[model samples]
Target: MTAIRDDGSERDRVLANGAVMAAGTVVSRMSGFVRSTLLAAALGAQLHADVFNIANTIPNMLYILLAGGIFNAVLVPQLVRAMRNDPDGGDAYTSRVITLAALFLAVVSVLLVLAAPWVMELLLDSRFSEPALAAQRDSAIDFARYCLPQVFFYGMFVLVGQVLNARGRFGPMMWAPIANNVISVAVLALYLVVFGPAQDVFGAFSADEELLLGLGSTLGIAAQFVILVPYLRSAGFRYRPRFDFRGTGLGHTLRLGVWTVLFVIVNQVAYTVVVRLASSGTASSADGTGYSIYSSTFLIVMVPHSVVTVSLATAILPRLSARAAEDDLPGLSRSLTDTLRSALAVVLPFALLLPVIATDLANVVWGHGAAAAHYELYAPSLALFGAGLAFFTVHYLMLRGFYALERTRTVFWIQCAVGGTNIVAALVLVRATDAEHTSPALVLAYSASYLVGAVISYAVLHRLVGGLRTARLVRFLVRAAIAAGLSTAAAAGTAYLLHRAAGDPHWVVAAVWVVVTTCVDVAVFVALARVLRLGEVTTVVDTILRRVRPRHVPS
Candidate 1:
C-alpha cells in the first residue's frame, strides 16, 4: 500500500461514497422519526412511553455493553487487514468471527431474558420499586423479558453491517434500518387501529399491550438483521460457518477488543445512571417528563452526525487503516483532518439551528395524537442536545482515526474521562432539577461529558497521528462557527417574524415555520460559505451543481 495523498479525484470518491450512505441515512432517519412519532402518539411522551421505550432500548444498550464496541470499532480494522493479508482472502476468518459472535449473542440473549427483572432493577430508579408503581414496574419487567431477545438480532445486524463496510459496501448498512422502521411503523399503526391512542399516559400496559408492543419491537430488530444477510453474498462473501477459531490471529483481535469493551462498560454505566434518573422523572409524578422525551430528541439532534460524520467516517476508515498499515502517519493525519473539516461544515449549522428551531422542530415531530399536549416538552432538551451532538461528532470521528491505528487502549482512557464526567454531572444535575426539567438537565450533563470527550479525543489522536494540523483545524472551526452562527441568526429572525404573524398558532403553523426557516437558513449559509471562500462548503456546492446541472460531456 502507498500513502493516500488528498488528491481531487480521491476526495471525490470519498465524498461520492459518503453521499450515497448519507442519502440512505436520510431516508432511514425520516422513517425512524415517523416510528418515534407513532410511539409518542400511541404511548404518550411520559411514563407510559418510558415503559415501552426503556424496555426496547435495553437490548441495544446491553448489546453495546456486551459486544458493540468490539463489533463496531475494533473489528473493522482487523477485518480490513484480514481481507488483505489472509491466505483465502479472509473468508475463513470472517466466517469464524461471525459464527462465534452468533453463538455468544444467542447465549447472552437467553440469559438476559431470564434475568429481565434484575436488569430492570439495575436500570430503573427506586421509584419503580415503590408500592404505588408496582403495576408499571411489572409492566417494564415484562416488556424487558419480551424485548431482551432483540439483543441477538441487534448484535448480528451491526456485525454484518460492519463486515459489509470493511468490504467497501457502505450504503447497505445505512439503508437497512429503514426495514426496521417500516416494520415498527406497521406495528404501531396496527396498535393504533386496535387500541386507539393512549388514554392513561401514566399507567401500565395490559397483557395484550405487552405482547404487541414488545414482540413487535423484537420483530423489527430481527428483520433488520435478516435484511443484511443477502448483502453478505452480494459483497462476495459466501458464509459457511467456520468453527475453527482456536489457532488463528483471532486472539489479537480479542486483545484489542478488551480495551474497547472496557470503554463501552464505562459508557453504559454512565448511561445506566442517566436512564434511572430520567425514568424517575415520570415515575415520581403524573405530569412529568422522562426517557422517551430524552431519547427521541437525542435521535433528532444526532441526524447531522449520523448522516454526515458517520457516513464520511465509514467511507474513509478503510483508507485510514491502509495509511496506518503503511506507517504513513502524515497521510493519516491529513486525511482525518480533511474529513473533520467537511463534517463540521455540515454539522455546525445544524447544531446552531437546533436552538433556533427547537420548539418548531419538536412540534412538527411530536405534535400529534397523545403527545400533542406535551410536544412542547421536547424543546429544551432538543435545544441542549445540539451542543452534545456537535461535541460527539468530533469524538466519534476522532475514534475512527484511533481505530485505524489500533489504538484502542488510548481510546479507552479518553472515554474514562468522558464517562466519569457524565456520571458525576448527571447525578448532581438530576438531583437539583424538577421532573419537568429532567431531560434538559440530563442533556446538559451529556454535553459536558462529550465536551471533555471532544477535547481529549482530538488532542490524543492528534499526537498519535503525528499532527492533525492543529493550526488549520482551528482556522476551520472559527470560519465554520461564523458561517453557522450567522445562518442560525437568519433562521431565528425569520422564525420570530413567522411566530408574530401567526400568534398562538397551531402545530400546522409550527410545522410551516420549520420548513421555511430551514430553507432560509441553508440559503444564508450558502451565501456565507461562498463569501468566506470556505472550501468545504464550496466544494460540496460545486459537486451538487456538477451533478444536477447540464454539463459538457467530453467524449
Candidate 2:
C-alpha cells in the first residue's frame, strides 16, 4: 500500500486509500457473495428479507451508538490529533474511549433486546397488521433480540478501524469487514446444514424462522469481533477493559456521539419507512417475501456502493484527520477536491450502467423468485444512486473536517437537511406511486434525492472553498457517460438477442450476456478514459497490474 502524504492532494490520498479500501471492499463483497447467496438459498427470499431487514437495522442503530454523531465526525479527529502529538498519552486516552464505548454499547444492546418486540412493532407496524404479518414481526423481534449484542462488537470495529485509518494502516483494517462477512456466511452455511434451514431449526419449538436466523447471525457477529483483535494486536494496540474517562476527551466524544445518534436515527427511520411502504398491498407473507427480496437485492447493489463509499471515506478520513490536526486548509482543500474527483471517476460508470443491466445481473447472481420484481425495482435506483456517493463521501469528509475542528453542529445540520430530504422523498415517491410495487419507486426517490442533495452540497462546499477545477472533470464525465451509454446499449442488445436464442432459459443466457457486455463496457471505458487523458483510471490500472506481476515474474 502507498503511504499517504500530508502534502499530497486529497485526490491522491483518496485514490491511494480507495485502492486499499477497494481491496477490503472487494473481499468483503466476495464474502457477501457467500453470505447473501447462502442466506438466499437457505432462507429463500421471504426469510432472507426478514434476516436482512433486521440485520440492516442492527448496524444502523449500532452506528448511532458507536459510530454516531461526533465520535466518527468529531471525536475521532480529536483523538487522532492527540495520538499524533503524543502517541503514548493518546493511546491511554483511546483506551478510555474504548472502555466507555464498550460499556455504552453493552448497556444499549441489553436494553434493545428487552425492547425488541415493541421496537419491531413500532418500526414495522404497517406490515404486521395481519395475523401472518404479526408472526413475521414476532420472528423479527426475537431475531433482533439475539443479534443485539453484536452492537458492542460493531462499535469496537469502527472505533478501532478509525484508529488504524488515522495511522494510514488501512489494508488490514479494511479487510476486517471481509472477515466479518466470511464468518457470517460460514455460520449461516452451518446453520443451514445442521438445521435444514431456519424454519426447520425452529420447527420443534414452534420457533419463528426469523428468530432462528437471528440466532445464527450472532455467531457471525462473534467472528466479526474476534478477527479484529488480532489486527489490533498487530497494530500494537491492546484493549484492556478499563473505564478511566476522567479526562480522556470523553466529553467531546459524547457530545459528538449525540449528534451522530440523531443523524443515524433519522436515516434508519427513513429506510424502515421506505421498506414498509414497499410492502404495502401484499399479504403478510408476501410482505415478508417482498421485504426480503428488497433486502437481498439491496444488499447485492450495496456490494459496489459499500465498496466505493467505505474505501473513499476510509482512505481519505485519516489523512484529512492528520491535516485537520495541523489546521492545514490548503492541503486539506486540495486533498478533498482530488478525493471527490477520484471517487467520481471510479463510481460514475457503475452508477450509470447498473440500472441498464440491473435485472439481467440480478437474475444471473440471485436466480428467479417472487421477489424478482423487487430486484428490478431496485436496479434502476442503484444506477441513479451512484451519482450521490461522491457528495455523500465529501459530506463525510467535510463533517470529519468540521469534527476535527470541534464543529459538531455543522455536521448535524447538514445531515438534517440531507437526511430530511431523503425521508420526504422516500415518503412522497413511495406513497404517490400507484404501481403494484412501490419499493422501487421508494428507492428511486431516495436515491434521486441524494443526487439532488449532492449537487446542492457540492455547490455550497465549492463556494466555501472558493472554486473547484471543473474543466477536467466535465470532460471526463461527458466522455465517460457517452462511453457507458454506448456500452450499455450494446450489452442490453446482446442480452436481448441471447434471450431470444435461449428460449425458456432466458435468465441463464442473460447472465452470459452481462459478463460479455460488462467486459466490453470495461474495455470501452478504459479506452475512452485513456483517450480522454483521465489519468486516475490509468494510474489505478497500472498500479494494479504492476502489483499483480512481481518484478521477477515474467509475464
Q: In lDDT terms, which candidate is top?
A: 1
| Model 2, position 268: C-alpha lDDT score | 64
Best by TM-score: 1
Q: Could you list the CA RMSD of all candidates, in the order they appear?
A: 1.7, 4.0
* Candidate 2, 218-325: lDDT as tens digits: 766566566766766677676677666676567756766676667666666666666555555233333323455555566765665567666776676666666655
Report the lDDT tens digits of candidate 1 across residue range 1-555: 544565757667778888889889999999999998899999999998998899889999999999999999988899999998998888998999999999999999999999999999998889888898899999999999999999999999999999999999998999999999999999999999999899989899999999999999999999988988999999999999888898898999999999999999999999999999999899887767789999999999888888888988999999999888988888888888888888888888988888888988888889889998988899999998888888998899899999999999998999999999999999899889899988899999999999999999998887776788999888888888898889999999999999889665687888888999999999999999999888988876676676457877999
Q: For each candidate, what TM-score against the reference?
A: 0.97, 0.87
- Kindly report which residue stretches of model 1 are placed more than 4 angstroms away from their true locations once superposed: 1-6, 544-555
Q: For model 2, where is the 10-residue window of minimal lDDT?
A: 197-206
Spell out the clash pairs found in candidate 1: none
**Candidate models: Cα lDDT each:** 0.90, 0.61
Model 2's alpha-carbon lDDT is 0.61
